[model samples]
Target chain A: MADGLRVGVVGATGQVGAVMRKLLAEREFPIAELRYFASARSAGSKLPWRDTEITIEDASTADPSGLDIALFSAGGSTSKAQAPRFAAAGVTVIDNSSAFRMDPDVPLVVSEVNPEAVKEARKGIIANPNCTTIAAMPVLKPLHDEAGLVRLVASTYQAVSGSGLAGVDELAGQVRAAAEHASLLTHDGAAIDFPKPEKYVRPIAFNVLPMAGSIVDDGEFETDEEKKFRNESRKILSIPGLAVSCTCVRVPVFSGHSVSVNAEFERPLSVERATELLTHAPGVELSEEPTPLQAAGNDPSYVGRIRVDPGVEGGRGLALFLSNDNLRKGAALNAIQIAELVAQQL
Target chain B: MADGLRVGVVGATGQVGAVMRKLLAEREFPIAELRYFASARSAGSKLPWRDTEITIEDASTADPSGLDIALFSAGGSTSKAQAPRFAAAGVTVIDNSSAFRMDPDVPLVVSEVNPEAVKEARKGIIANPNCTTIAAMPVLKPLHDEAGLVRLVASTYQAVSGSGLAGVDELAGQVRAAAEHASLLTHDGAAIDFPKPEKYVRPIAFNVLPMAGSIVDDGEFETDEEKKFRNESRKILSIPGLAVSCTCVRVPVFSGHSVSVNAEFERPLSVERATELLTHAPGVELSEEPTPLQAAGNDPSYVGRIRVDPGVEGGRGLALFLSNDNLRKGAALNAIQIAELVAQQL
Candidate 1:
């Protein structure tokens, strides 16, 4: 597979990092060597990547002189401080956090949506779009290319994992509470217990919460996640000034993210044309049967139920649903994809 | 309390009926007498209302003659055929299905939205709006009264019980299938054997199914559930041509039906004002923190996350969320309230 590439994973002990390592191994990336980098809390531990155990270095104190590339899944703060240092050493940083996405100098991407943007990653920090936006872009961009996206009204069913380990813990606790006793609230019958809310602001067991991120600036422009959807779409599709309004919520489901998108187009978009286009679109899987669980652990963005928006007349506008693995396409897989492209260019 | 009323419950053994019976007992409806009716399969089965025992009659065969009022949670076929007979026998019928909801002669009522509609049940059928519609109606109607509803876009996360016990079983079975290790298609996860396919069309475990009923009329307005969301909203809200487009999904959630709605009004409606209105609106409980589990067995149509629709300008519109016990205000509680209104008019 050409010359094998040397790879380094940042935030190696975190959820997205673990997934990144797994995907790299599963996809059989031709790795000549592998290394991991984490915070001091996880220094010296080794991760199994393609049959080799790689030592993890601490970002603050460890040297990165030999690494060819470093993938960062740590939160925004860590990425802000460490990404540049690694890049200064001539290592490309494929960052999974939101740290550099909005910077005009740094390109935000979904591999299939805007792989071309990678060349413009002058800052060395290539940003991954928010998971919710990533799941939708692969499907919508192609359609929008055909029928300009004039405006959109969307809602999302985001899985707990979007928040990481804490999210998964919250749901397990809430569902247990639902099983144990009847809630005075409504009627799921016996409530089961998981834990008191140590993570999310509210109990998520046997329940769904609409509060994704704190109300975005008086609940105006967008929730933090919602804005990611709008601005990220603009950047990825290379279409600025696109009007996108979205409502994103977190549900009890453990892994995939699902969105119901209503797009009003400048021209008309018939179901026939849209479906035919999506049928062959890269990174888009036409599921005539899209659902959150069916999307769990899979890579392709699942699209289904194409119909007229009725809100917008004709074949001119339409609505559909999307679900995809937030951890993979949403984070790790996309990072690996960028690294793959960089390995070629370097 | 107003000379205790005699009540009969049709489909008493079904999911909504069971909930209806529980609500009747829980709310302590002023019942001097109570009777249970079901399809032939459940005939002779016992239903315990309070400390008393009542045997369910075969709704298809048993006459509706001896009741003061009958609550029909039975399916539409039963409602269409039997409601008239019950009304002819001097029993008012509060139907929980779509059979008569759009019928001009039948008053579509949600106690809080249109208790007055009960006075207009001339054809003897007091129709209940579909569950998803009812959950949002009580909250939306008040907002509509203040600001004319221009358009509405909604996505629902409905529980299994909306389909009945078999639905709950289907979801339960799918969860267990994970332990057994089976591919999604061959697993047939719906538990009750009766829970399997030929019913839901696809698996329901850990997933969300976008379309709820069969694709009717080539899917322009497919699914019996979708039609009800459209048709029922029109009749109940007095908007003959309301812009109601929806994606009704069945989630792994067991009870409440949660909706994410983006509603536009002729005049501007702020999220704060909607919250204020909902707090005092009849039949609506203002949830400081609204969630599906918390609103489960409760009676209120809880509304929260009121915010202006960023998609629209003019400060005239808002988008919010709702989670209500589909069995309560969406089904039983509403039916009972309609029955209450009919008794008063009589």
Candidate 2:
């Protein structure tokens, strides 16, 4: 414990927060002292750390002092109100919410793609990219380096777990209720009476919804998740003017987010070269047929189905598919990885 | 009955064949007589026509002397072996297989997109576009007419039924077997013992497989389904030089295929205009957020989530998502519609 740091896990009772707690121990993060913080409803409850239980503190009233780092997985509003206060208390905040990602003073980071950006966190807050965006960053970084990436068209097959625990419950409930009507569902999907959808606009079991998030009223009819993919990718890749078009869709799977990307670069990129680069790229594993199931409990982004995008001239375009665990690499694991980088500096 | 034509339905005992028989009665096609044909195994099986049962004939040995039009939903090899024989007997063949889709003489037709191309079937065979490709044709045709479409980047969320009844059975079996393991599947997808995959390379329950079909040995790593999307779209839209890049993925849904498209055109097209064009386009319907479940057992291609592709210059690009019944508008309905067109000409 001699050179270890004290850490706090905010939103400690949530889905992503549970993953954070598990990873912190699995990776053997150098923690001298650990604390858990949640909402008032869950405060004072005990959560296991390793061999002992830690009492959950109410995030609103708890003193975040003495903590060297705090990982916030609560919703955006909670982060908006609490992150700055923790940062002011001399703790570096690694936020998994969308609250401060677009803030210029805060660096949005995917640990493998832009670890150096950690040093640019002038506000003492590092933001993790959205799960869908994070899944593609590790795979696209090497390709972008080989060729000057100019444009990207991405379509996502996101899992229900990305919406948190409510999403998991919705899908599970629907499947349990509708699984017996396989014959009806096979022929007429709408004929089945699914449990009323609450987490999403439609039933998530045995179905694919093209709308993953609420539509932003920005006149573009684009979902917030789609905007996050474009904005976060541009910020992390350090290409402010990068052209992007994304469609975010939610599938019935419980975890792992998959993206199908068609990228055009200023310079020509061959399929063989892209394959070679991804084969050795950090945090990326080449798969023959990448699926959300194969990536649900994995850390690396499993990427495959690489081919030339016949749409772009001079072989300047390539198409690929990739999947990564939305909870681990997309959120908890990356936040902890950033914590590791921050610990070295401390 | 005097103006009605004699029709023969090849592969009349399979999945799409079942749909064709139902639709023929529903749409009230002008048929003087109807004959059923299938493989030798199912040859003598009796299928219900309007008010009577029709005995299935072995397609390989069937005599097509009396039929004026033959709709072939049989596999490519079966069509390759028997379609020409049917055509030689003075029957105009509307093939749902890929045997003659790319052939110079056989005009690949999507009813709403290029009905005029039906006259160019010099080999007496009009090919139905692939189910995945047919879903996008009506949606893209109206847009292309408004804006000279140049390039398309498509990522598909295809249903398992596209592979045939075997796909539906595989998904149903896995879901039924794994439904009780929802907790384990939600946490770790690979932890469950899903039924062995037969139609696909991975478990289709609670999973999204990026590879939809067998990979062609075309050195591009593109699946036959992906290639069909590119080739059939070009032929149906009559754009010989259209640049298309498609990633065909199979999801757990039983029916209906969905596509997310980012299209670049020669002219600038606004979202409002694109929406208006699609609203009035034949065989098309506009929904707020289209899902595959909504399109199942439906006729029109349900399209929504229309937006400007910020990637292309001067609003020359548009991004949209669409869903259509793969068995209806994609296969059976279109082939029957072509038969109606031929009946009118006769």
Candidate 3:
């Protein structure tokens, strides 16, 4: 395990997979040998790394031996079928899928918030929090520590890339179509002919979709993305009693996700105190006004617009807004950062 | 005032004011004489209504006599200066700006929620609620009627049209720029040359700005839009002590404004009951998955994604999302509806 670290990137041809490779190079992660894996369709394709081409192997039937660590960005079903195999082969798998995030034996880790929880991964598979939840962790960690956060109400303005490359292509195609017609912006919903939407339930060009992920059929009537916000926040924050209500809305942005968070804490906290604490918090940059475009290439959660919530009694609640790059800090970079933390243990 | 009614549209060339004229014509409101008013720049412009061309008069210096109702959508300063003069002339002024919304003498009306409050316009002036607040009223009215709503937490995805024509041009210009260089979508944030943003503080193309209105500088650190949500909701809902917290965000959509509302009531309400109530709620239409595009040219607030907030006790709270056209229902339609209600009294 000592010739630097043998690393494998599952789903190497996908959007977040591409970001994972870029972050691995940009962050200078210690890598001796790098392997790429994709589905059968992209198996024989080559992806550039440093000046060379690495051929992607089919992840469905690949040898997982001799790899010190594997970062899985494949879909949930693929990870459910393959992550255990890699973990069994003595490869520590850090998965970005939602498959094992709530598993008792698999620890969901945000590198900056709960790095200590990494040691509790008895399944040898550390789960990455959902991209939306990941972007919120660093911002909430400091506030939760100070006031003992009890509840969170969040409304998300998520990027299309959070859906996948297909989502990106859908938005881009529609934007081009709408640009050509120009009537799409001026008239009613059906005035302009958009390409039939195959990826999302509605048109993604110049619109805001309230439901992000497909609605889970359970009686709760919450989307998988909304449920993930609840379950993942409870698990990562280690607050069994923390109450979370979230509305996940997808906007037309390409790379960044922004959240409007109203957090209620047990102890009293003021806007000035919350802003002061956030100024020094790790992985958070306080700004006067934070937007997704500014956060697209940045790493920290750009937080601002802090105010007191009159809804929460006696100033125990604070409302703030934050934007973070969904592909970077939300998915790939966090997984790579967790792997780097794992390397220290090795 | 005998044969139909005389109507004047102040700021006739503006976005919401244009919609006001269109709606007045579409709804076939009883209009015997129609007049247009604007600043010195647009004073002489000719606007058509049916078969006649109406010349725009300078609102500041124009005699307000003989008008039955004046719908003012101009900026706050113009409204503040002109509304009282119209009121003194015995003309009912329905202002769309924030100028008279908080004035106790001027009743802030949402048509569906507080139609009875319209008769309390002591200053002979009625105020239209903020666009974001107007979007939520129809959706909230029924639920609040069934179960006494005690608290509200709202996060808004407001459109650029809420800012006026400059905002529309800025987003259009930036999208064209980003489209010309496709590398902007593929690469980082700096890869694109966006037009220098003149309307907003940040780039609104392919991005979300968390701060919609500039901070009011009242030491509360809230944007004027956020404050409007609180003040106007209390006035319209007749809930003086009802708690409210809101975060207003600007999205790239052209016309629709969507709100994610988590409302806590004193009485228990299930998703079934809430959906049933909303199905019959005036000015609200229940849909499966409501998006901004579908609501852009529509009159109703398209409400969907209703679910139970586990965060609230005993199913006393419900979380839902709604989209309504900012220019149509949010501003112009509501003002027109108030005028019709006032027409009955006339």
Which of the numbered candidates is closest to the native, going by highest TM-score? 2
Task: Give candidate 1's error at residue B22 in angstroms.
Answer: 3.1
Q: Write one digit per residue (lDDT tens) for candidate 2, span A78-139.
A: 99999999999999999999999999999999888988889988998999889999999999
Query: In the order shown, what is each candidate's alpha-carbon RMSD?
Result: 3.5, 1.3, 1.6
Model 2 ranges off by over 4 Å: B1-3
Docking class of 2: high
- Estimate how well candidate 1 is docked, as a DockQ score: 0.40
User: Which residue runs of candidate 1 sit more than 4 Å off their true CA positions?
Assistant: A173-190, A217-222, B176-199, B219-221
For candidate 2, lDDT tens digit of each residue in B235-337? 8888989999999999989888999999999999999899899989999999998988899889999999999998899999999999999999999999999
Better of 1 and 2 by TM-score: 2
lDDT of 3 by residue, B1-346 (tens): 4689999999999888888989999999999888999999999889988878889999999999999999999999999999999999999999999988988888999888889888999999999999999999989988989999999999998888889888887787787777766677653554556878999987988888878898887898888898899888888998899898898888988888999999999999999999999989999999888877888888999999998887789989899999999898899999999999999898
Task: State the lDDT of candidate 3 residue by residue for A1-346, as single tens digits.
Answer: 4668999999999888999999999998999999999999999889999999999999989898999999999999999999999999999999999999999999999998999999998999999999999999999999999999999999999999898888888888887777766556552443657889999978887899998998898887788999899899999999988899999989988888889999999999999888889989989999888887788878999999888988888789989999899999999999999999999999
Each candidate's DockQ score against the native complex?
A: 0.40, 0.80, 0.67
